[model samples]
Target: MKKLSMIAAMLSLLVSTGSQAMGPFEVYEQALRNDPVFLGALKERDAGQENRAIGRAGLLPRISYNYNQGRNDSKATYLNERGNLHEDRHYTSSGSTLMLQQPLIDYEAYANYRKGVAQALFADETFRGKSQELLVRVLTYYTQALFAQDQIEIAQASKKAYEEQFQQNEQLFRQGEGTRTDILEAESRFELATAEEIEARNEQDAALRELGALIGVPSVAVSELAPLAQAFQSFPLEPANFDTWHALALANNPILASQRQALEVARYEVERNRAGHLPKLNAYASVRKSESDSGNTYNQRYDTNTIGLEVNVPLFAGGGVSASVRQASANLEQAEYELDGKTRETLIELRRQFSACLSGVSKLRAYQKALNSAEALVVSTKQSILGGERVNLDALNAEQQLYSTRRDLAQARYDYLMAWTKLHYYAGTLRETDLARVDEAFVRR
Candidate 1:
């Protein structure tokens, strides 16, 4: 079993590099087939969907048939006036019956039908929430991998700059134009950069592993994202009202809606239990054919037919019915509390994501400016080095700063996208169509 589990895990990590490029939505479609958690929810949804039919069956007529074939033997002893007589007989006997019963007035069954509808609705909402959650999860994993890849690039660029600085310092020292201290500092910096490069590469690999696990692939490479300005400018977030978003969340959030259904079903349970004490009426019909033996030693066959209405009036039940009603009522109260809790949580999350999304635009702009300033600083430092106003080390530092700022800028863009998606998810407005614009934001690598 352990080996099989390992194999499954390994298969989930297998990568198909030859396939066409896959984005967040494309990967999610793959996860729908391979993600175990989502698959389990799908099965549960299908099973819950059967509740309506199951409940309907209870309100329909039930028909049954029975047949029997066997041999029967009999022995008899009798004492008369002055003599005793014994007789033995054996025969084959067969019987068959067919019956149908229909409930005329069953309050509990009616309540059950209502409960089934509510339960199925609850399952629907739950399943929808799971589906929306899949998009968020896939996007998160995909972006994280990209972010890790960026870090590695930054580290390698820094490493290269430091390597050049070290070589220059070493040559200057040999020519007596630089001090030994300069060479030592440059060498240390290069070594540190190398270490950073190794660490960053490892992080990138780990990130890819996580992305693979999510999409049931061993390895993956995400396409490069479009420049922030082009993407955001083309598709800007508008009508940023927190109250409006919160209202939408309250109205449509699947988790909260599912909880609402739960509460309704609980109310039905209380009704069903309360109705248990009410009288029940049913109509029944039956027909039977049997073989029998008479005292005269002759076999006979008979047919019987029965039809009647049955009325069951509850007189007393040792308080069991009342106790059941109380239990159901308590459960109903609990469901009400659960629904309230779900509503509160959904509102809180909606506010958080909405705030993030609303502010993300400005945040991206600020990060972009920061990256620009860093790049300008690197150019200015390089000119200063040429003029002997700054050393090679100063130019290298400026380059490192530029890359760091760029990475942060990229991170902010991704954060904004994530917040946007999560806000829609909270509002239960996320769909596959929402990804179309986002997909355009990725250029094929």
Candidate 2:
């Protein structure tokens, strides 16, 4: 008896521990930390920074060295005063030269360096935007997991209710008080409830696995989500127009900033193309040595060194430089247009999110009322069943209705949470610090 009691106590404790383990927020945080997409963005941002440094270095002078060696043979004819033509012997010559050159004046290099710096800044903004996107994905999946859990609970409750009713009908039928049809009906309902419970349990498992995969912890366990009361203690609402949201989005959205930077880059590209039309000055130095030998004739050796500045004036290039400049200018215009289009789109998205949030608030209130009504109906149907009325089917139907209402309420609550997240994200207020606020509200002990 003592061993049996101890085993039973341990089992009960295990069940209790399983019921109140970690919450969804913790899981999502862990997942975010390990997300591959987020990590990739971080690496890409670092690479962009390095590329920017390379660009900045382009403003400095460039130097190069060169060497050459060759052998040459030639024959020449000479005419003397005596009118007798004499043939000059062929000779082979070898020469090598070393050269160093540096650009003294180049406009395009400077413009490209500046563009690289702007692109680096844009990369930083893109990283931040990726973080926000990951946050949304994690939160959405976490909420789905919680909803699956709620469904499991509802299924369990319905299964228990149906089982009890089946047992009672079986007893009544055995005593000749209930018809066999009544017993069969109760049995069928219980079986249906059992099947639903199994399916709900399977759905819960799949949701948990998906959540685990998303957060990069395939082995981690998920605890039930806390009740909605703890998740939404206070609703923060502010009156704001679409203009306000547009301003925030334009100011804080990484994609918009990147587009602006792209325009700057395109403008610089145009400048770079125009620089092709200007004179390029370079300083250069070269040293050369040569040796020549004619068969059985003579041997000669020579060395020469020269240093000077060379200026290249592009008199003409088949109009290529002009065409390149025009193309760059057109790209700059397109970049500007893209920036404007993105701004308008962000503003529209912000307005839509705000409207959805407002709608969710009202929907949650209606769902609350509907839940209460469903609960009252369940209670009344139960009483009728106990008072010897033919109310089994009605009671069962009421129980199902109550579960549906509760599920709807849960959905509304999740929608409100998601809408709030979207609104904050659009407002440029979604940050790590803001996540703590959400954690406090949505994560319970």
User: What are the per-residue Cα lDDT tens digits for candidate 1 across 1-445?
Assistant: 7466546645543442234355666666667766777888898899989888877887999999999977777877789988999888688877799999999999988999899989988889899999888888877777777776677777777778777878888888889887787777777877777787688677767766666666554655444222223345224554567777888888889999899999988999999888879999999999988886344433888889999999999989999999999999999999999888888888888888778876777787887788889989988997898788998768767877887787777787788788888888889898887775666676544
Candidate 2: Cα lDDT at 58: 65
Looking at candidate 1, the ten consecutive residues that score lowest on lDDT are 224-233
In model 2, what is the error at residue 194, expressed in angstroms? 6.0
Candidate 2, 1-445: lDDT as tens digits: 7466445544543454465644445555655555678889999989887757877666665554544444545555557887766555555556677776677787877887888887788788788888877767767766777777777787778778877877887787789776777667767776776776687667767766666565554433445454445336236666456667667777887777778888888888899899989998888888877676333334777788999999999999999999999999999999999999988887777888888777887888888889889999988888887887745778778877888888888888887777778777876667765555565666454
Q: State how far residue 388 of model 1 sits from its true place (Å).
A: 6.2
Clashes of each: 3, 1
Q: How close to the true structure is residue 79 of candidate 2, measured as C-alpha lDDT?
A: 75
Highest lDDT: give the candidate number.
Answer: 1
Candidate 1 residue pairs in clash (backbone atoms < 3 Å):
13-218, 14-218, 15-218
